[model samples]
Target: MGIVVVEICDSNFLLSLNIEEIIESKYPEVAVLFNDCLGFCGLCRLKPYAMVNGKRIHGKTPEECLEKIKEAIEAELAFYA
Candidate 1:
């Protein structure tokens, strides 16, 4: 099994959601990195977003973003799994 890397900027955590916690709890072999900065300040501060497999994924709402992030992870995991 390979580890999936999820990069999240440490700018603003939208809607008080714990992204790292969610990812850790959902995926088995995964690395959730609360990176210092992913160089996306506007996106990070505005809405809920994450970088899965180096791809930016964002959502209108926190819940939606969480689900999308999970979906992105699953999609990436599919390739490696």
Candidate 2:
């Protein structure tokens, strides 16, 4: 399988989690990047926003987005695995 890249932008604690660090530490095959804006202002206004493999996810809290991202990533991984 290929690398799974999760791009997060302009979030509060979600960005603070150092997602890149966490992903690199736990799943070396996964690459996480943090940016300023994802060009989805509506979603950004929701606070925690992330792009998992090019799919946009917006939520009120980091935890909310994190759960969804994990599920999505796992599903994607399972497909290729």
Candidate 3:
């Protein structure tokens, strides 16, 4: 995989997965940042999601969002392949 930019909400209560660790271990090339807020507090406060390559990937739960994010990452990396 190539460079994947991910930004996630810093609130632990809202997410069901340890996003940073999961992606770091599985996709070493991805650069993920956890911020206090991504200016999408309204959405971030409601669902589990990540901004992958600037695209918003969302899911009702963390596991689902993580999978979606991974798919998005693969798709973006494919462009470089």
Candidate 4:
């Protein structure tokens, strides 16, 4: 099993997702970390932005963002396997 970490910064929308809850529900092994600022203001301005394994996703809804993150995590796990 691999560890998944979600870092949320200044983005209010991202914070609203309650990422910890979602990750724990779906990916138990995955760990989510909420930070103050990822320093990606340009992307944050787009709203509902997140970084999935270091890749930036901009202007996403909570559901959409979670889906993308899950997909990325699955892909990472597959690579390890």
**Could you tell me every candidate's TM-score relative to the true structure?**
0.85, 0.76, 0.86, 0.76
The ten-residue window of minimal lDDT in model 4 covers: 1-10
- Over 10-55, each residue of candidate 4 has an lDDT whose tens digit, in order, gives 6547667677787768777666766678887656656676666676
Least accurate stretch of 10 residues (summed lDDT) in model 2?
10-19
lDDT of 1 by residue, 1-81 (tens): 336788887775643787777778878777888777889868788887888878888888888988888888888878885
lDDT scores for all predictions? Answer: 0.78, 0.71, 0.79, 0.68
Q: How would you encode candidate 3's per-residue C-alpha lDDT over 1-81 as one tens digit per residue? A: 338888888863335666778887888888888888888757877888888888989887777788889999889888877
Q: What range of 10 consecutive residues in model 3 has the weakest lDDT sum? A: 11-20
Which residue ranges in model 1 land beyond 4 Å of their true spot? Answer: none
- Kindly report which residue pairs in candidate 4 clash with one another: none
Ranking by lDDT: 3, 1, 2, 4
* Candidate 2 wrongly placed segments (more than 4 Å): 11-13
lDDT of 3: 0.79
Query: Candidate 3: misplaced stretches above 4 Å?
Result: 12-14
lDDT of 4: 0.68
